[model samples]
Target chain A: MITVALPKGSLLKDTIRMLQGAGLDFSGFLDSSNRQLQIVESSGRAQGLLVRAQDVPVYVEYGQAQLGIVGYDVLYEKEPNVAQLADLGFGSCRFSVATKKDGPYRSALDLPPHCRVASKFVHSARRYFQSIDLPVEIIPLSGSVELGPITGMSEAIVDLVSTGRTLKENNLMELEVLFESTARLVAHPLSYRLNVDNLSEYVDLIRQQVLVVA
Target chain B: MITVALPKGSLLKDTIRMLQGAGLDFSGFLDSSNRQLQIVESSGRAQGLLVRAQDVPVYVEYGQAQLGIVGYDVLYEKEPNVAQLADLGFGSCRFSVATKKDGPYRSALDLPPHCRVASKFVHSARRYFQSIDLPVEIIPLSGSVELGPITGMSEAIVDLVSTGRTLKENNLMELEVLFESTARLVAHPLSYRLNVDNLSEYVDLIRQQVLVVA
Candidate 1:
């Protein structure tokens, strides 16, 4: 049986729909009453491991799951060794630098040297800062990064901005967008190369569905 | 105004109750309709910043919040530079090594050397294994770690066991416990040292309430 790692949050619904379009049904994960982390599809040809967005790549990389659906932001941050199969293209967002609306800094380069920037995506934040040749401290925060500026913990924050509502509500403004991110289908490198469990056929079906949606 | 960082999840209710006992009412956070991340108490003497359990210390460490409530397990893992004030004594649980119920391993030492152990508390896991002179690869997963052993990704998982319901439901058993943990009151070192915003008086009040309950 082919194991698919499905992310638990925002990307889940669309991911499941895409899989369904490809003749796989792991919709049991979407049931609020279903607390099972691992679920087998209706036909039992494939199983789904409902995991955190960050861990989706980990599962696929470790070969436990032959395929996974994850956000590009997570893949960029984690840099897990997995094959990029197809862009499912449903969840879309951007990694951007945000700061207090009334704060002095207007852009990434405007902040002073060694200014602290809080983020959950520390790896991406660090790389962005380094690319600009700016020296800054990236404080890793797990959640509610908008509080970073509100609480005066950092001069700015680097985080995923979906609707710009969160930033606006918190009195923060975007300084610069690092990149756009969308959900992507990924697979274990070895498994994909070996065509284990007819991996390519599943990938092809998912890709066709994505193309149909696009 | 004194800013207190309150954890968002499981610890929030009890922490709020404790604060209420100390004559501060930040129970606005408990109102399900309330979407505010930062809230001022009814009396306005203190305000609260609701954040993730792990980010509690970060808020306090940066002095954005002079005081915070977090789990001891988080403190043990993050090892942030903050003064541990008092044990709140609620939200108690233990960090333990667990494996599949039918697995060969019965204890931490029984597992083969270099076996992968998944955990959210990598710091504690590493320290525990190192102390026992056992070498294990610790896979850091963000959430749903029970899926680690279930998916054959790891030999064991080092996670917090509260009621043991999650483990039992997943057909896993505890191997060895690292330590017991409870909610703790923490303060920024500098804030506590300088007695900022009459911090000591508030700490004393909370400590008195803890003693009363104990």
Candidate 2:
């Protein structure tokens, strides 16, 4: 079976829609039972594996799943050597550097060397600060990164700001946008090599639907 | 107010029991409709911040929450460097290295250098392999780590296995245990310093309850 990894939660809804638009009807997956972690498509040619949004790329990169739908933020952080075949055009958000509304960091360079910043995306944060010639101490936080700047543990935070309400409510302001994020369809290099013709057809179907929406 | 970070899901039930045992009662918290993320205790001197289990340490480490209840698995994986003042003595589990029941690996040394192993605890996996003089490629996966060995993406997996049922169902067997895990009560270093007497008293209450259980 040609296995695909789908991220759970908010992205799952849009991902299912995208798959349906691509002529891959996997409605049986809507059973809402925890036992249905893996599902078979109507055609039985493809199978879907539900995983955390952050781990989608790892599944595809390791060839456990031939393809995966994942957020751009995770892609930037993991930097897995996989084929970024197509953009799924949903789950949009922004990767931003945020600080307390009253803090000194107005720009990226305003952050002093050795200052501590908290983020789940450690690699992306390191690369961003390195590009600005400042070595930062990154306190890797799994979640609740907004609490970092609010409580004085970090000088700034790099996190996904969806509606900006969370940041505003916490008295935080966006200093700079690191990247605009959206979900993308990624494929394994070996998968593409082994099933080039079939995978290309599947990609074409999804791309046609995306172009229609565009 | 003294803010405490309470882990969401099953752990929350055990935490509430522990707090009640400590003579702190907040019955209103049981109301499911209380969308209010923050809640005040009856005493009005303490408050609770509901957050993900993985995020409990993040809140406490930043001092947004002076204290937190989280699993030892998350604590070891994140390594937040906070003070673990008490082990609440519930939510017991262990981090185990598992492989297919019929795979070649019977011990850590049986795996080849540079062989890939999948795990949610990347830091733990790296440290364990490094200590054994084995260089490895750690495939960081957030969930369903057992699938790694099943799909041939990794030769073994390091994950929190409460019972061996999941591994057995996946045709896998435990090779070695990395750590024994349980729920822990963590506190921020600066928060403890700022309110030494109050925090120490709170810690003593939890420690006493844990001793009773142990």
Candidate 3:
């Protein structure tokens, strides 16, 4: 039995649609109740675990689930031991370096030696700043990265800017784009080796569906 | 007027109780409408801003609000520019180091040179481990730190453990305790200075209430 972990919000609808297009029926999940955590498909050969977007990779990496659908930003931050198969072509966004519109920074290099950059993705934020040889203090925030600059808590912020509306509202501007992100189909090594036949069948079906949409 | 940023979770009830005990009537907050973000006390002298537990300090430090009620764990992690006035005495929990029941680590020192420890408080965990000279990696997870070690995505996790039930059920064990946390009344430095007369009155009232319980 192959278990698949799916993100619970935002990308959930599209994820389910793609799975259904691949002939994996999970209409029972439409119940919209707490009991829908586990969904049994029409074929009964696969099961889906609906979990938080961040927990999908954790489930798959621990072998609780053989495969997962998650964003590139999360994968980079977590550095989980999973094989990236293909981009599912939805939930596209960018992790960018942003600062107050009136700040001294005009580019990554313009950031001060000990400046602070706030973000929920602490790991990614730290690495990106360090890679640029810009010594920075990474102030970790759970959400509302825009508030960081507005409150003068950080010199800038490194966060995912989907439409830049949040940044604009807070008077922050994007300085540099770090990574263009989209959701990806990921698999665990053990699952790939052990359930090659069954996994490939499902993978091929999903891949063909994605190509059709493209 | 004194602005108070109140946590919107487990401690919200006690927070309101304390305010009422101080002779400030804020019963309007009990109505529980998500849209009612701000509420003015019946005294018409005090107002409340409903925010996430972790964001209490941010609002206070930015002078958006004068005082805040938040957990000690959050205070330790954010280390914002706020004076710890009184321990309000609710929403208590401990930031504990937990790992799989039969995992390699027997103690914090037993962790491998590069073993990853997942947590939402990346800075807090990093400082704690570094202060002890432990060469461990920190994998920041927004929530559900218990899922990290169980899923093999991290060697251990640093997270809040109130009853330890969640960790036990997930097959994880407490390896070490990092800090004891409780909700506290914190005030901004400038607010404490500028509104010393009124702020001291509010502080004294809360202090007396805490003493009665103590």
Candidate 4:
């Protein structure tokens, strides 16, 4: 039997639904009260390991789970060793540069050199600044990165923006978008190469689901 | 009015209860229905900024909040510029090194050099390994460090151990404890030094409550 790692937050429901569409039964995890981190699908074809979105690639890379569904932002940030199977095109969002809405600066280049830029995605933020030849300090914050500018701890923040509702609520204004992000199917490279446990078959079905969504 | 940063999860209720003992009411945060990130105390003498546990120090360090309640592990890991006022003593836990219970290695020293050790508290782990003159590779994981060992991603994990229940459930055993962590009253250094917003009096009262708890 094959194992698949499913992220546990926003994209979980849709991911499980897509898998069900591909003939996998993971409805047990959809129950609100189900606290089980690992659940066997009713059909015994595969088991699902509910994990943090960021850890999805880690599981697949280590071969504990032959497949995983995670955000593209995470895939880019961690750069874990895994094969990108398909972009499911769900849970769409963008990685953005933002500042306090009232701030005088309106662009990434306007922020002063060595100024702080807080983000949970430190790697991605660092690369973005490096690509622009800007020298800004990237302060790593796990969550509530919006508070960076609010608290004056940083001049700006690089965080995921979806629906733009949260940025509006936090009094932040988007300056530049780093990239568009969407959930993608990822698989262990070796598992795919060797077609272990018919990994290719499941991946093809999931790929078809992605194309359907797109 | 003084601004305070209170963590928003498990320690929140107990922190508010302790503040009530000090005659400062932050019960608004205790109300599960309260969605406000920033809420004023009943007396209007202080306001609380509900934030992630790790971000509490950031708020305090930048003077967005003159006072904050957070775990010592965060203080040591982030190494923010804040004055450690008093140990709130609630929310006690420990920073520990662990591996799969059945692993051959029995201690930190037993793990081979260059072996991967995963942790969210990367700074603390690095310092601990350095102090011991070990040069192991430390992989930063945001959460679920236990999965590091189980999935063969890392040989061991350094993480917060609250009840040891979760670690036990994961089939991991603690090899060594780096330090015991507890919630602490941390203050913005300049705020306390200048006694801004009558910070001294409030800290003294909160300190008294800690004494009572002990």
After superposing candidate 4, which stretches have Cα over 4 Å from the reference?
A42-45, A110-115, B42-44, B102-116, B130-135, B152-155
Error of 4 at B91 (Å): 1.1
User: What does candidate 1's lDDT look like per residue over A1-214, in tens digits?
Assistant: 9999999899999999999999999888888898888888889899999999999998998899999999999999989999998888899999899999999988889999998999999999999999999999998899999988887789999999999999989999999999999999999999999999999999999999988998
Looking at model 4, residue A205 earns an lDDT score of 89
Order of the predicted models by lDDT, top scorer first? 1, 4, 2, 3
As for candidate 1, its clashing pairs are: none
Candidates 1 and 4: which is better by TM-score? 1
Interface RMSD of each: 1.0, 2.6, 4.3, 2.4
Q: Give me the chain B TM-score of candidate 1.
A: 0.98
TM-score of chain B of 2: 0.93
* Residue lDDT tens for model 1, B19-51: 999999999999999999999888889999999
C-alpha lDDT of residue B88 in model 4: 91
lDDT, candidate 2, B57-135, per-residue tens: 8788867788899999888878896888887889888798888898888988898899999998899999999989899
Deviation in Å, model 3, residue B16 alpha carbon: 5.0
TM-score of 2: 0.85
Provide the TM-score of chain A alone for each candidate, in the order shown. 0.98, 0.94, 0.95, 0.98
Worst 10 residues of 4 chain A by lDDT: A142-151
DockQ-derived CAPRI band for the predicted complex in model 3? incorrect
Off by over 4 Å in 2: A100-116, A130-137, A168-173, A193-197, B1-3, B25-30, B36-40, B58-66, B102-114, B130-136, B189-195
